[model samples]
Target: MKSPKASSVTIALILLLITGWLLWSSAAAAEETPYIRGAALIDTHGCLACHSGNLMGAMKVPPLRGCELPEEEFQAWVLYGCPQAQPGRAQQSRFGMPAYEGHLDPEDVQDILAWSQIAGHEVPDQAALSDLARGEQVALKAGCFDCHGPLGQGGIKNTGSFTGAIPGFSGEQFKHLCDDGDPAAIEEWIRHGTSERFLSGEPLAGLGRSFMSSQLTKMPAYQDILSDEEIELLVRYCLHINSLGPMSAERYEAHRAALASSKMEVTGQEDSLAGPSLPREVAELFSSKCIRCHGPKKQKSDYRMDTAAAAFQSGDIADFLEVSVIQPGAPRESLLYQFVSATEEDSLNEVFPMPPSEDERLSPEELKVIRDWIASGAPWSDKQTLQSAYSD
Candidate 1:
């Protein structure tokens, strides 16, 4: 009805209004997304308890303050502990991280992802500044500091029934003893736990065994818990620490003196033995592997072996020792021997065998040593004799 130019201008104005409306709608939707909501959810869940500086247990809790990961990957990790993005690696949390699959909706996960991305962007890249900074973060997040020290120097862990003196990562002797700048070896140790040999085929021998044994808490096989990428980061951090050279002698000696003073408080001074002295090797084996769960802090099934007195005094352990002994010289009759010696094929119905977890079982050679010791009458050794032998 109107002129063509007037009608054309009206139509153009309507189209412009529609475009503006669409833009407004898109912005509003983005603003309303769950990521904003995730910020509140993080606080409500008390996630900072373990992930923050206020750690709950002896286990290391990886920090999430500046955590960076792909959006999909981050969402998956938040919803389901660990993602199976990679093969040959099982997903598990040795240091408890509860999954919030059903409890949190898709919207919740998205919100959390949003918050993490925002927070991550906020954190400055300190690792870029210095190797020490990177190493410190890795150590703290991986829990090295929990066992080592605040400075990655030596420290002692004295948990009621167990006493372990952790060596400094910076020590030249420790660096040489562990590995020779091989990241793969370091990575292997991180994933599968450290052994008496480095990835470069170096023998830990006497010093390695002593150092490994000094760790009061068993080093967990992190392959199940950490991603391969995370493990690589840790290796880089450790290598950097090693390059820094040994801890100051003064600090190391001070730490040792402090440990000596506190040793009695951690491991009760009960030194009574009922049988012949056990060999030093056998005692060291017990201290490193057996004492963690069976000793003072936690005694599963009322069995303990922290002290010679505890080993002989505990009725259950004493009975097991007696029943397992065959004619005072046969190790095969011993239930303790049988449990440690059982192969996967033979242990179908057995109550989860000794060292409970499959990853932490004693090696074949270690098992043989235990078997040999049991066969040799399972003699009880005094602490002083054992200590003197260790010093030699």
Candidate 2:
């Protein structure tokens, strides 16, 4: 009954509506996990990146245990720097948080205040602190920032190197330094000053090796200076900062602009890994033992390891870096392997183990299977295998 032009217009409108809804739903569903609470943000965002201390109010990190600031003032001081806080800047010191304004939302501020009322008064359990927080202390004590720069923002010039600078933990400079794929390379740097992976690999290393060897500021081996535990902490810290993307407001807006005009569909398993077909045994193991938390629907930290990709992912990192759940060929470099292997320790260093429930914890034998599977290459099983696993 409608004219052709009228029908065409209606169809266009319907398509527009559909696109908008998909975009909205995708945005909403994308962040399946809860936001970090205000208190954790301190550790997660490395509020201590600039200042070192507690909420009880020190010079910069501050010590605000029992004391309370008005909401508006608190928000102003945090979201916007307090001009009054900057007195005299020492040569090696900084005042106020990083240049991140508008990254946090209103709910985040409210959450922070609420937490201070309850938990802020008590001395924080060092063991309870996030690895990122703990790693900050370790780096400070060991004087890593001297070379790496504050918060591992390495910008110190190194003559003869390809990039001509010591690489920071995150960003293009770091990717330029190494493959940026495996954290083991990070560990190797800490243990031996230079990793084999970095020296042997291409694009930079092969061409840059002569320059790297001739550089004025060479990384010193910490084998004697640091204990094994301290070494692990340092690696975690480096990886933590390396991954904490510090997405600025401007860049995110540009991302939004691109998204607004793009034809990208936000399917449910947006973060799903794409790789080799998953084997039946692995699929069965994941469906039975892991999928409840790291499944297709509800993922903690956006890590849905049980998706058809179902390769591996133990947990999230500094809240910004995007790490694939598993690296197919390397078990030692895989967080999934490390978490499963170290679950027995439940130590301060280890992340909360996969399948956090004590009763549901994987057996040693099961862990061995995971290790072997990872070492062999973490392949995702087929849909039939997944269906069969679920059936059992």
**lDDT (tens digit, per residue) of candidate 1 on 89-116:** 4244632765666667667765665455
Consecutive 10-residue window with the lowest summed lDDT within model 1: 247-256
| lDDT value, residue 6 of candidate 1 | 100
- The reply for model 2, stretches above 4 Å from the true place, is 1-130, 176-178, 203-206, 247-392
Top TM-score model: 2
lDDT score for candidate 1 against the true structure:
0.54
Return the TM-score for each candidate structure. 0.27, 0.36
TM-score of 2: 0.36
Candidate 2, 286-328: lDDT as tens digits: 7787766666656776676645444344356413334445654
Clashing residue pairs in candidate 1 (N, C-alpha, C atoms within 3 angstroms) = 34-111, 35-111, 324-334
The Cα error of candidate 1 at residue 241, in Å, is 1.8
